[model samples]
Target: IEKEGWSGEVSGRRKDGSPITILITASLVKDEKGEPICMMDSFVDITERKFMEDELRIKDNAIASSLNGIVIGDLEGNITYVNDAFMELWGGDDISEIVGKSAVTFAEDEDKGRSIINVLQNEGNWTGEITGIRRDGIPITVQLSAGMVYNEKKEPICMMCSLVDITKRKEAEEKLQRSHEELEIRVQDRTKELTKANIKLKKEIEDRKIAENTLLKKEKELELKSLNLEEANTALKVLLRQGEKDKTELENKVLQNIKELVLPCIEKLKIYRLDDKQQAYLDILESNLNNIISPFLQKLSSKYMDFTPTEIQVANFVREGKPTKEIAELLNISERGIEFHRNNIRMKLGLKNRKTNLRTYLLSLA
Candidate 1:
């Protein structure tokens, strides 16, 4: 062997042109002269082992950087290894403080620790939710998943466990459940209110229909009464017209009977001789008979509504062709009284201070 005898690890190339890793030992073969002749070197291939070592290193790094805690423990439940996440999860600052400790020391409950040991011993694996206590004595909830590490002979060696924190997730689920229940209660109350309102609305609609029907019936009755009143008014108008016609005919008949039947008898009485006073009486009777048939008296009385009965008599005598003296004597009044009545008649007839003859105006009325 040369100076150091053996080398630790060496890089080399194989005969197949592939890269390989090896461990080398070098020694010198000497002649009897005690001088170096040929150097002999032995190479041990470690390519497989190097590759396995690299893979293991990569896996170790991965475990250290994992978000979930990772742990390795022996069958006796003693901690053999732990990643950075595991140490941090248990509130530890260094791995040395946890490496030799019992794995069950992390469990918050005694029964949980016993159950975990029993599962590892009997079934060789365990996984479920568990409460874990930290170095600060604060408890946390985690989902633990563990499997048995086995040797080539299938014998159990150690236990590997992964822990995932689920405290926040559980709290969120409980809050959501409570909110769903409250929403359901509010919806039920709103539905009940709507049902009551719908019932009231239906009743109001029914009452409105009844009121409208009552109003319609009353309107029809009023319309029928209006029609009956219109018919009665028409019949009364016809009766009034007939009564006016009958009154006109009766007035004509009365005038005709006085002119034809009484006037001739009065004219024949003038032939008998009599005293002055007796003759005056007969003239007065004839004048009265002529006035009874004069139609102008009735017309003057109707035309001048304000004319007194005495004024009307004076007007009738004046219209019958009687002199003012005779009218005054017959009515037992003075001549000035007769003139006063005539002047009043002229004023009432709207002929005052005009040239129209009073006798002519009175006769024109006939």
Candidate 2:
């Protein structure tokens, strides 16, 4: 009585009273004469099929919402499917805009595209970096992982690919490399500067050492010269002492010769009769000669440092028993000068106010 058969999926209970899902087809069965007899129905268990469909739907949703772009392409490299992420990655508005395109259409280089195809065909998979172009023609870098899909018969059917953006990572790596190179250059420059400074310091130290050595050498030379001068002065002092001793011995010998040889001869000549004027000249000569040769004169000069030469001469004449006028005539000086000199000698001898006579003190010294 129905014009057409009805088919639908329905829920049912199994023999164990468990709930199940099935596909049902119902139609009207007729006997004859176009009269309806009974209704006939067919049931097909679809629980597994429904479950498989639900799982497939969930998987599809996961792929659509993935952060990574996904593509399914035929073995001929034609695009067959694309997820929402893939569309967004390629800057496409809809899957319809990308599904019918060649899989290699977005590859930046034709040669690289061909290579990727060849690797996928031979190895059944390819994973590497690739340059791709967006819908706006902007080039981008990606990490691509692609594999060939197979049928149940193991025949290659299509290629499944996943893409992840790697542009920022590559940029960071390049920046780090540049910074490392710059740091290396700076370290090298600093090392060179330190080396130059070290060299200069070494040179300065060497020059200072040389100056110190020169100063030490000069000091040594001056010390040696001073030592030589000291030795010369010592030798001169010894020679001067020897000369003074020789002069004293010579004066003693001259005084002895006058007393023994010359004075005795003069006394013998006085025994021969001489005129009065001659006798006076002889007395003056004897007095002068005795004064010149007297050891007492040397003793007075040495013992009395304050006595003048004239005072020493007056002392010698007074010691010889000559009066003041006679000593003046012998010395070619005035009598007053002789007396003054005698007075000075007595003062110098510490006998000015004493009762001791100058002549007696002189005789006592002799």
* Candidate 1: RMSD to truth: 28.5
lDDT over C-alpha atoms for residue 105 of model 2: 77
Task: Give the Å shift of residue 190 in candidate 2.
Answer: 2.7
Per-residue C-alpha lDDT of model 2 across residues 1-366, encoded as one tens digit per residue: 298979999988899998789999999998879778889999899998988899999998988888999998888788988888878888878778888787787899978988898889999999999999998999989999999989889999899899998988988988999999999999999999999999999999999999999999999999999999998999999998999899889878987888888998888888888898788889867876776666576677668968877787788889989899988987789999998898888888999889898899998876
Stretches of candidate 1 exceeding 4 Å from the true structure? 1-4, 28-40, 116-128, 206-366
Candidate 1 lDDT by residue in tens digits, 1-366: 645455668887878988899888788878999778989888889999999999999998998899999998888788899888878788888788888878788888867887888888899788898988988998888899988889889999888899988878877877998999999999999999999999999999999999999989999998999899899989988997998799779878977887888778877878888899888888777766666565666666556779987888888788778899988998899999999998998899888989998889888998
* Pairs with backbone N, CA or C atoms under 3 Å apart (clashes), candidate 2: none
What lDDT is obtained when candidate 2 is compared to the true structure? 0.87
* Per-model lDDT: 0.84, 0.87
Give the winner by lDDT.
Answer: 2
Q: Give TM-scores for every candidate, taking all chains together and pairing residue i with residue i.
A: 0.52, 0.55
Q: Candidate 1 has which clashing residue pairs, if any?
A: 1-27
Clashes of each: 1, 0
Candidate that would win on TM-score: 2
